[model samples]
Target: MPVWTLYGIRRGIATTSWPEKEGPTQPGVLGLPHYHADRCQDNCRACADVCLPGALSFESCEAEERLALDYGKCIGCQLCTEACPNDALTKSNDWAFGVRNRDDLIWTEALQSPPAEEVTRKIQKYFGRSLHVRHVDAGSCNGCESELQALNNPYYNLHRLGIFFTPSPRFADLLLVTGPVTYAMQGPLRETYNAMPEPRWVMAMGACAVSGGASGGGYSCGHGVEEFLPVDIYVPGCPPNPAAMIHALLLLLNRASQHVQGGQVAH
Candidate 1:
């Protein structure tokens, strides 16, 4: 046997039991910036001005101006955290910011989705315990794909959960898509979705896949998968880490509860 195989045997299991229990994310891995409204300095738009993807914006309220944060558009560059003078927007490890409703990723609004009982029951009824996913690259910079590749690694060991990546859309129960939808890819994307049988679900896999990221509504691409495909889950990260992706998948299956609401992070 190879030296690597012997090393693995000595090291025992590398797969993590996460979601069921707490686990450590990569050290110093920057996630979304947290905004503390009380600490925000008045008349300052530092974070908003520095945000390239429009994740941070100034929302005008009656006689007051407040910053609006949309996690769906955030690439987790932590630029907002660096721009803040009052330390209002601080860096965090809040990487599991996935949700079924897009509004949950926005800071300024409260939008409730379909009741969990109704939707989750339907999904569980059709998909059962095993899920086969087909991933599509609509229009990407390849960053999301890089993160996705980690799912099958020894550390994550995705197959243990019974979720799999399939090559054929006809066998896929879920369409997990990354990147913004380019004009050239529009027809092919629809073709893939149509190929999948009914009870199929779609998941937007990144900031680019959720809101087209920095290239949203551009001449070459549309605003992520939501513009065309019916997205069942919206996972927002420039390239959400492996753990975040796992959480998103489990969330879709109703095996996990969402801790994010209106762009707020619980841990």
Candidate 2:
């Protein structure tokens, strides 16, 4: 027998059983910020002031002034948490964040964000049992790329779930984008999206791709992938882990139901 085959046999199955069963949890994985409005001072804007990506902002509503946290724009820098004098924003360990709608990422004190939209059977009808993804790094820092690469590794074994990453956009069913969509990559990104076969979908896989991350609002970088591309799913994190990315993809394919709401894991 081949040495590689022997090693594979010794390792057994390394794929994670998740969504259907509990799997290993990553240590030190950061998640969305938990908000406690009651803990906030009446006139405080400390957290908003320190937020690098403008994820936290004090907005004026008809009824009253409120703070809004756009999870799609958050990079999990924890600066808001650290700047909160009243503990209104705090760190959380729940890293599973994936949503179907762009509006689901925005949260205000008075308005409760609606649950993510369910993937209709139509999507499943086309690419349900199997999915082919084309990943484009517009201008990533390689953090998101590293996580994307991990999905194919033994521990994740993305292929076991019938998902695959392909080099050709012509054969892909999904466009998995990373980075903030820099000006230099805008045209190529669009061309790649255009090259994909029909019944295609796009997923913003990280804070950078979702909302430009830390580089948002820069002159050279686009705000997010959605600004140019019609994004079908949004996964938030500086670099969302493989599990979160998989959850988003599964949701897109109608193979799974959403378990994340307002950055909290419902399951």
Candidate 3:
């Protein structure tokens, strides 16, 4: 037998059984910063100041400045954790932040789920176990693309889950969008969405796709695809890892349960 073949044999199956079981891909990598609003000090905007994407912001209330943390705009840069002198914003491993609703990504917000049976029936009827995705680059920095490419690798092997990425939108059940929708790509993005059949879903695949990331509200960048397209899923990261993406996609198909609500991860 060839040496590589022998090595493979010794390794057994290289693919991990994740989403189905406890197959962790990235071990200790930091995810979005976890915010403890009660721990936050008065007049402290340190975390907000260091935030590049404005994930951490101040909301003025009745003679009070409440720190608002929006996971949709978080890029997982860890700068806020570093800048926080009050330990209000801290690093965490809570990367699997896929949600069915957009408001669930906001801090201190409440989230409610639809009837599971209704959702399950609808998903099983259209997608079942097999999901065909079409990725559209409105205007990405390609960080998300790099992580997305890892899905088909030997470790992750997204195909085993019956999820696939199709080049043509006509055959896709989900339109996975990345980046802040640029002015030039807006027309093409709309055209692609129009091609997909009814009952189609859209997944905001990154911080840019969810809420425009670092470049949002800036020159040459729109807020996100959600401004125009109806997003069914929101996966926020500078570039969500393959594991996180897998969770989000499955969450969309109702094959998995959403863990994050009101910007808090369920244990």
Which structure among the candidates has the greatest lDDT? 1
Query: Between prediction 1 and prediction 3, which has the larger TM-score?
Result: 1
TM-score of structure candidate 2? 0.91
lDDT for residue 3 in candidate 3, whole number 0-100: 93
Instruction: For candidate 2, give the lDDT of residue 91.
Output: 91
Which is superior by lDDT, 1 or 2?
1
Most TM-score-accurate candidate: 1
Off by over 4 Å in 2: 110-115, 262-267
The backbone clash count of each candidate, in order, is 0, 0, 0
- The residue-level lDDT of candidate 1 at 85 comes to 91
lDDT of 2 by residue, 143-248 (tens): 9999999988888888888899999999998999998999999999999999998878899989988888888667899888989999888888888877888888
Q: List the residue pairs that clash in candidate 3.
A: none
TM-score per prediction, in order, is 0.92, 0.91, 0.92
The lDDT per prediction is 0.86, 0.83, 0.85
Can you tell me which runs of candidate 3 are displaced by over 4 Å? 1-12, 109-120
CA-RMSD of model 3: 2.5
lDDT of 1: 0.86
Question: Residue-wise lDDT of candidate 1 within 1-267, one digit each (tens)?
Answer: 579978879999888778667868577788888878889887889888999999988878998988888899999888889889999999887788778888889885443443333355878776658899999999888888888889999888989898999999999999998888999999999999999998889999999999989877868889899989899999999889888999989888888878787677655
